[model samples]
Every structure is written in C-alpha cells, then in structure tokens.
Target: MFGAHLDGVSAGPGINDNGSGSATLLENALVLAQRNPTMTKRVRFAWWTDEEQGLNGSDFYVRSLSATQKSYIKGYYNFDMVASTNGGYFINRITSTTAAPLKAYWDSLNLQPEENVEGQGRSDDYSFQQAGIPTSGYAMGAGARKTTAQATKWGGTANSSYDPCYHRACDTTSNINATGLNRSADGVAYAIWNLAVAATPVPDDFSMAVSPASGSVQQGQSTTTTVSTAITNGSAQSVALSATGAPSGVTVTFTPASVQSGQSSTATLSVGSTATPGTYQITIVGTGVVTRTTTYTLTVTGTGGCNGGQLIVNGGFENGTSPWTGTTGAIGSPAGQTPHSGTRFAWLSGNGSSSTETLNQTVTIPAGCTSVTLRYWLHIDTAETTQVTQYDKFTVKVNNTVLTTLSNLNAAAGYVERSLNLGSYAGQQITLTFTGTEDYSLQTSFVLDDVTIQAG
Candidate 1:
C-alpha cells in the first residue's frame, strides 16, 4: 500500500486508503471551528503522512518538534491504513504513558468494553509513544467489498469488500467504495466527542434525611425536628430547600446560613409555643427534583384530665362516644330521612328542604380539657332532579379559630376522622361552634355523632 502506481509495477498513490483520514481531519477541523469548541484544559488535532512508508513522516515530525511541543501532548492517536480493505489498529504503550481518559470516557458512557489484544502503536503514534505518550487508533477489516451483514445493517453490500480492488494492479479509483461511509464517519465522530465531553458530563451525587422519622407530642410543648442530607461527590453544587403544610406556631429553617450541596449540615424545626396539635403532613422539597415528606403528630390533651383513643364516626364505634352524640336516628330522632344507625351518621349540610332535615348539635370541653374531636360523615351531595338548589355546608370553630369548614355534603361519600392539637386549650374551656352555611336551604340541622372530648 505504498505510493500508488497508475498501471502497477511501481509505487501507487494510496490516496483513498489514508487520504480519506487526512481529508476527513481537515474537514472535521473546519467543522470544529464552526462548532466553537470550548476547552478549559487543552485541544489538539493532528494529520500524519508517510504512514505507508513505515511511519517515516510521523517520526520526522515528532523528532523535529521541541521538548515543550512534545510535552504538551498527553496522548497520541495514529491513523494508518484507516481505509484499507482489511487492516486493524494497534497500540504501543511501552515508552509512552497510556491515555486513560479515553478509556474512562468510554466506560462512563455505558458502552461495551474493549477487548484486549496485542499489536497496538504500529502507526504514527509509535514515534510520539517512543518519546513517552499514550496512544490509540482504529483499523478496517481485511481486503473485501462491503460485508453482507454490513450491507443489511448499514445499507451496504454484504458480500463485497469496502476496498474491493485493494492494493493491487486493479487498486484504482474504482476499487474505493463509499459503502457504510456515513456510518463509519458518524461512529468515529460520536466516540471522539463523547470522550471529549465525558470530563463533566455527569453531576455529583446527593442525599437527604429527616430525623425523628415519626414523632408525637402534646400540643404546647415544643419539639425539635432535625433536617439533614448527605453529599457524596457534590464538590461544587448548590442545594436549596423549602417546606409547606406545617402546623401553626411551628418554625422550620435550614442552617449553615444556606442550604447547599456538601457535608451534613444542621437544620432545626421548632414547634412553637402556640402550635395547634394535630397530625400534619409537612413536605420538604430539595433542588433538582428531589423530594421528601414527614408526618408529625401533635396530640392536644383535652380537659377532664382524659385522653381518648383514635375514633372514626361510622367505623363501627371502635372507641364509643355513647350519649355524647350517638348517630342512631332511631325512635324520637327527627333528622335526615335516610334510616340511621350507630354505624351511619347524618352528614350536616344545608340541603334539607321542608321534607329533609339535618341533625345539629354542639359540645363544649371544660376549661380542664386540652382538645376535642368530633368525627362525622361527609360527601359531595350533587342535587338530583328532585332537589335543584344545592345548599349545604358547615363551619367548625374551636373557641374562635375556624379549624375546618365542611362543604362535604355532596353526592360522593367521605369519612371524617381527624385530630386537632389541643395543647393550647389545656385548662381553658373550648367550645366547638358549628354554624350552618345556609339557613335550612338543605337540612336545618347538622347531625354529627361520636363527639369525644380529651380533657386534661
């Protein structure tokens, strides 16, 4: 494959064989200029000649260069017989330190691992490598037209060789084939750039944590919550965090003055002196799609020096509230038209016309009680053809503050079983004020059963 002879019997100009690589390099360089390649480290590209002449051209090029010029290069890549009908790349790392960046780059991309074989650096890289520089290169398969498999896969002749009329008397322009050229070009380009950018392709790893996975306390007594996260390789990253849905009288703030990526920092969540006690869902969202949430229980002790267990209005009375407000619409009960039992309570809304009536009642916890719970039934009651003017909703207030307002008297059914933090009302009387949203528009009375008072 030396200098090509037009009619053979002499050296032939192997333009297509290696000229392709040289031409490609020049074109690619121009393209790089257009691309505005930015590099904080360094950038280098080279074209080698006399590769068929025992790499003499590359050797002279390396020998003539100054030590500084040679030292500037960390690795070398030789392109020899890059377009041969059948030829393979080889590496030489004895004198030259191998360029490990390329291998690391390939590994990070999750690409297939390279198979180890001998015969490397049998090209221009040998000259630079002899002076101590890492090297790598590529090669083509033995002389043959496009492969049958290659043709099918890449739309090229399968049984034919890429360089059909390889280094022979017939090795003319006709021998050169463009089959799979685009694919080959693309593959090389992708690999080079992929390696080039692998330096900073991936961001650092991060982690977060919330202490006291779950906690419970009587309202009024402050509880300290801790926030923390781990930074594995976040050497230079910013981590910001914020929270919502926390109970009143509670203050949450991140420390180290700022929330950023790095080390375990301390952040304190302070439940204030006047916090309403209840099981609240607090969400803490981190930067860049990281999220975590915690459920905290703030139990408020009620008057009467008693704390009742959890309850559900229509959940079959696990914890009974007899005589307090039994939901049984039995004898003498003149509320909702629907048949009522202990397990089924009347949902109070204003939907009661003259025929339909809602059950309404109020309870007060003595000054000794810290909190109270009134569990009932609720649902979205959509007006049917019979009742057109939908009117039913209720507001609940503890002393003065409206804890929860219910418009849940709709067509769909929903269970109501919730707790309020009552630490603030300890020794202070609390009255649950239930006011009808509308005056008998639906039901004149709001019937809520299973009223339990947890008095301290």
Candidate 2:
C-alpha cells in the first residue's frame, strides 16, 4: 500500500506541503495503468483526507481493518512533501525491509539519503506502524532548517527551511523544486514496480556461502573456511563478516572483516587447550543493507568434560524479578491468572486503557552447548468483544529483533507451549524481551510462565 495526504492546511495553497506528493502518486498511477503490467502483488494507492487534523483518515482506515484483512497487507509506504525547494532526500526506516527498495533506488543514483527523523510520528505511516503493520516512506523536508552539511550534499543554502513558503500563501506551484520532483517521482515508480508489478524473479542484493560447511578440530588446533559473496542484483556493496556460537577458549576471526560484493574472505577458527569438547554450530553473518547468514558445524574432541544445562537464571519468576527488568508490578502472581508452573509468572498489560509494559532479561549461553532451545508457556485472555480486530498486542524479541507477535486475535482459554531454537546464539549473550500494548478500550493479558533456555 502506498499513501499520501491530499488535504492541505487552509492557510495557503499548500502546494509544496502535499501537492508534490499528490502529483507524484497521480503520475505513477497513470503510468502503471498505461503499462498494465502483470503484478505479483496487489498495489493499492490511497489519498488521505484530514491528515493535518492529526492523521484521522489514515488512523480510521487502519482501525477498521479486521485481523484477517490486516494480515493481507504486506507493508505501507507514505510520501509527503517530497519536492521541497531546499529539501534533503530522506527515507523513513531506511534499514527496514520495506524501505530497502526506496534506499536502493536512491543509491543507484549516487545520492545518499538520510533517515526522515523530522517527520517521525507526524505522518500517516505512524498510523500503520501502531497497528503492527510494517511501514516506511520518503520525505523531502518540512519546516526544519537544513544544516551546512546537508546544503553541501543536496545543493541548497544552509540555515534555510526546506520549504520557505511552507503553509503560506506563497506556497504555490512556484514553490516546487523541479529537480527534486523529477528525481522523487522516478523513485516512487521504481519502488512500486519492483515491489508489486515486477514479473521476473527478484534476485537478492548479495549472497553469502561458506566453502567448508563443516569441520572437525582437536583442542589446541585450528580450522579455516572461505566466505564468498556475489552480486546477484544491483551494484556491488560492502559486506561485513562476523562469526558467532564459538565456545569458551575458542576465537573466530576473519582475515578482512569487511569485503565488497563478488569477493571472498577467509575465516579462521582457533581452539585453545582449555576449549570445551562438543559439537557446535557456528553461524557466519554477512551484514550489508540486508543481512545474510550461513551455518558451519564444528566438532571439537578433547580431554576436558562438561555437561549441558539450563543457561537462564530464575526463569520461572518464582524468585521475583531479580535478573529481569521491566515495568513495575509486571512480574508477580495474580488472581484469576494461573501460572503454567510454580507460584509466579509474568503478567503484562491487563489494563483496559492505553498502556505499555515490558519484561526483559539478559543471559549468556556458555560455549560447548550443543542444542540450545528456548521454551515457555503462554496464556492470553482478552476482554475485547470483537473477533476480527486485533485491539491488543504481545511481542517476543531476541536481541531487539522481533521473533514473534501475538494479539487479541490469538486469545485462548488455556496455556500453550511455545519453543524456539537458539542454536545460532549458543555461545552469545542475548537479551530476551516481551512487550505488551493495549489500546484505549480493551484489556488483554499476556501471561508467561515456565520459561527456560536449555542446552544439551
């Protein structure tokens, strides 16, 4: 879904404020209709109204979606004020998957775009984001002043507002930046075509494949493998290499930590005399604009002995929330909420009003642990009457990356066992977090208990 606000402030023509975005969308739509290309995914364009009045149109549209309808929407992209006279190119959530194509399009033109911090939570995209839909967007600028560095890169006077005529009577068609408009329009088309209308298979920006996928070494020995990358699509980009899951007394290094696409690097794994003896799965991660990972199995034989065990401390919440950190009163035994086991559990966000609560703990997984798994039991109860709308949400994240999300739509009567593989982070310290959010009207409780991170 692509969206832009059509309404403007009543103070002036508001040409540059939104006319630029509206024009860009209109032109793109016309071109798409003319071509009538085969589409891999459906494309929907929306011109919102009453946006200047606190994004009411977009918010209402998102709130009206049923759980099934929301699931069908892959992402949302917003374009607003893209042709400010002195505008600096900005892409919202530039590192997100939904924004990759937008950033790539700008990169292809040798233009470095910055994140659109000036417009955060001020546009229609924020409405979608609050509803758990992935969102990204493009913006030139608004009333914010451009810095000297921005002027040097984007060619405009320093200390000047991106649009001098912003919200004024002078903000007529003359306020538009021709060059910015042309460039931005092309980018919008590029993104729409690549995301929805492309008929050919979309190649990954790059690939990461290790030569020796598995190896065996004794304590005090070493092994080597080659990490190779190729530019499957677009121009070459720099990829940084790192390895994880090495046990204690083991060191993993790359000859050159970073490599350009279509290049290769050597990874060395050295084991010390005190290294633990076990079978380990080492994950090699290549990070660029996007991240790619591959696994290498290593078997270590040594005289030292150790047995796998649970890595998390006080996971069951019976000892209180010592190692865990979160909102006050979030971890405790509560009436009407049964714990999966023990006398306590984490109960987050049962308030029938707007509220947010979180619980997180950091733990290190020792080396030499073979099969690592995180397990928990979850129970959800909601006071929401609707069966289709997801009025409340629960999320689980590892190292700040989302692993799973649940909502009022997933409410059930009893506890359900959940398990996730943690082999990739076997020898790493990671933070696990559970966050719950409730809307203004409904109360939903996300209950968790019997949490454990076990390694064998």
Candidate 3:
C-alpha cells in the first residue's frame, strides 16, 4: 500500500483520501477473522479512519492501544498518503531508517516497489520499526527518481518511479496503478502461504516425502531401495515409483512398481558396467501435495553381470493318444513337440471309431529345462455323412497349476496355442495335459501331434 488519501481531503470531508485503505483493511480483517481457524497462521488487519487532516487516525490508534496489546504485534504497517501519490512511493523505516532485510528481499526479486530517497516521508512501518519491530510490505508509489542502479538492476526507466498521480484531484480511482495492485495481491498471497505454514498452526505438507527412500546411483549396478512416505493427516494416498534423473546406461526395475495407500515398495536399480558413474535422482509423483523426490546413489564403478536367466521350459503334453512312439504312425505326431518356429500340431487317425475319450500325450518337464511353454494341437475330421460331435474345447495345465484353464479349438482347422509365464517353475518337473473328449460319426477321425518346450 502507498498511502491513504481523503476525498476533497484538503478542502472538505476526508473520506476518499483514507477510505480505500480503510475499506480494504476492514474487508481483509473480516475475511481473516472468518477463516482464522482454517488459516495456518494468524492474520491482523486494521482500519485507521481519517488518516488525513494530519495522520490523526493512525496517531489515535497508537495512543489507544495498551502497552501489552502493542507488544503482541509482530509489526505495524501504515497506509498514509497512499491514494495521494503523484510521485513514485518511498518508505522510511524512520526518517533515517534501515530495513535491510525487507529491502534485500525486494532487491533480490528486482522490484522497484519503494525508494528511500527522503528516508522518512510517512507510513505505519515507521512507527513499528521505531519500536524495534521489523517491518516489510509493498506500496503503490508516486513518480520518484528511478535510480540508474535500481533500473539497470530491476529494469524500467532509470529515472522514473511507478506512479505520477500524487496528491491531486486527478487522483481519481482511474489514476491508480492496476499493475501495482495486482503485484501487491500476489505478494500478499505468498505472504499468507508462508505465514500460514510458519505459524505452526498447520504443517506445510508441500514438503512431504518418501523416506528410507531410494538413493542416487551410477549405471550398471543393481541396488535395492526402500520407500516410505511420511504424511500429516493425509498419508500419501498412493506413491508411484519410477526411475528418472539418472546417468545414461542406468536402468531400474521395481517389484510392485507402485504402492497404494500407506503400503511400501522396494525397487531394484540396475546399472550396467557400461553405465556412467553419477548421482541419480529418483522421483515419486502422486497425489501428495509435494512432488516427493528421492535419489538412488549409483557409483557405476563396476560393470554389470547381474540379470535374470532366460525363461525356458522343456515339457511334453498329455493327450490320451498313443504314447509318442518315436514310432511314427500313418497319423500325425504329439502336441507341444516343436521349438522356435514355435508351433505344435497333432494328428489322430480316430481308427474309424467314435473314441469318446481324449487322445493325449503325457508332458513330463525334465530338470534340464529352465522354463517351459506348452502348446496343444489337434485336428478332428469326420468322413461319414452322419452328424458328429466335435470336442473342440480343451484344458492345458502346468503340473497342477492350470495355465490355460479352457480353450475352444473352434476352427475347422482346429488349432490353439497359449503362452504361459512359467519363470517361477524353473528346473522343476511340470506336466501339460489337454483333456477333452469328442464324439465323431462312424469313420470320423482326428490327428494329434507336436507338443514342445524349449529350455534355457
């Protein structure tokens, strides 16, 4: 605020001069009071009516407060001659004042909010600072000497301040600096946020985090990291773990990948020996107020040799068909019996009889295979004109775990193959079974063959 002015202040009623700041102070006070409990900090706003005629309103306020009441105040800010500025504004901590902290804060942001040219013109900050209180705030200024130093550093005319409507009837509502008002509003917002958090009323959850969290790391090394989020009132609703801000050649993999609610998750960060050594920052983005950042320290000092083995499984399929007699019959072979062209085919003669039972082969996973993929194939064709029943749906199982619970081999050229994730059952004996029985017309026949599993 620059200063408070009076309407026809010099000639008559002193309402317009100080009325604006008073109205503002009253509105601000009422709003703050209403939201006081919800506010993270306490806010104080006051109105000094009739600041004109000689700063009488302000003087009276000072004289009216008790010593103890005044002592509770952190600082006091004044708004005298605010609406009266034609020259740029200036603030005096006191005529010969020094408010370095407040000035420095303004200087850091490169704003020409106020000048100390006269050092002591007028305002509330003056009385407060004189009482050993630190004061700071922004004001709409009048046309003042915008120093080459302030201008070069802050940018504008090194010779002109902000406003040019100081103390004149030309100082209508239209003469006010909207830019100054907007900027002051923004400053107020920042002050409110900072104060609300600093008041110890409510914690600033913006800085919330995930702890025992991941650290930085270099490329090519495998490291485990734990993440825990400390929340106030609202624990992180859900934290998603991801790799980022790390050096090249570094890669990370997670166990659960994401944690929901207060749940915890561990991730495995791997950097290849080829990885570049450097610090890596891991970020967890979520509904949390703050974007929590944790790092996985990576020293890519060594090459990487750690990784999972290839998943492979060598297993046969079980169909009631004749045992895979390396003895080739006129019909086809067994199911799951082939590799990387990765297909399996089975053919059956049907013996011209309506075989009501499934023709199958027993798939025995040997200890030699790391993992296994089982495929079942069969072709059913009836030569007789009489209607026949097609047993097209079948079940595929890995040992007792049902990999393919049910599959409908509904094609005229009946064929179905399912890929199963069997990495967990490496080197373990497993079995694949396809169970389904079909009724065929007299002379109807089918073929089953090609059950295969590739090993690591």
- Model 2: clashing residue pairs? none
Tens digits of lDDT, candidate 2, 1-456:
566452232112222233223344334444654553556788887877777889999999999999888888898988888778889999999999999988877776666999999989998998999989898887889899999999999789899998888888988877887666666666776777778875543444788899898777777889999989988765678899998898898888998999998899999999888776666888999998778888887766553322345667778889978888887387888897988888898898889899999888898866655667889889999999888988999988899898888999999999998988887876688998889999998799999888888764
Error of 2 at 389 (Å): 74
Candidate 3 structure, TM-score to reference: 0.31
Instruction: Report RMSD (Å) for each prediction in the order shown.
Output: 18.6, 23.9, 22.0
Off-target runs (Cα >4 Å) in candidate 1 are 1-139, 142-208, 230-236, 285-370, 377-456
User: In model 1, where is the ten-residue run with the lowest total lDDT?
Assistant: 1-10
lDDT of 3 by residue, 1-456 (tens): 112222322222222223222233323433544442235435666555654455466567666767786666654444333332333334445222323433333343445455444434355455555555556544544445556765565345656644445555566667654333433343344344334433333422323244445443333347776655454433345556666665566666766776664566666667676654333455544344445655544434322211222222222323322553321343224352332223333443334443432433343333433334444444445444433334433445555455653322233454445456554654464545444333443443334445544332
State how far residue 338 of model 1 sits from its true place (Å): 18
lDDT of 1 by residue, 42-145 (tens): 44555666665777777887799788877777556543333433322212232223424333322333222232233354456667768765565433433544
Instruction: Put the candidates in lDDT order, highest first.
Output: 2, 1, 3
Among the numbered candidates, top TM-score falls to 2
Score each candidate by Cα lDDT.
0.44, 0.80, 0.44
Q: How many clashing residue pairs are found in candidate 1?
A: 69
Error of 2 at 367 (Å): 80
lDDT of 1 at 94: 23
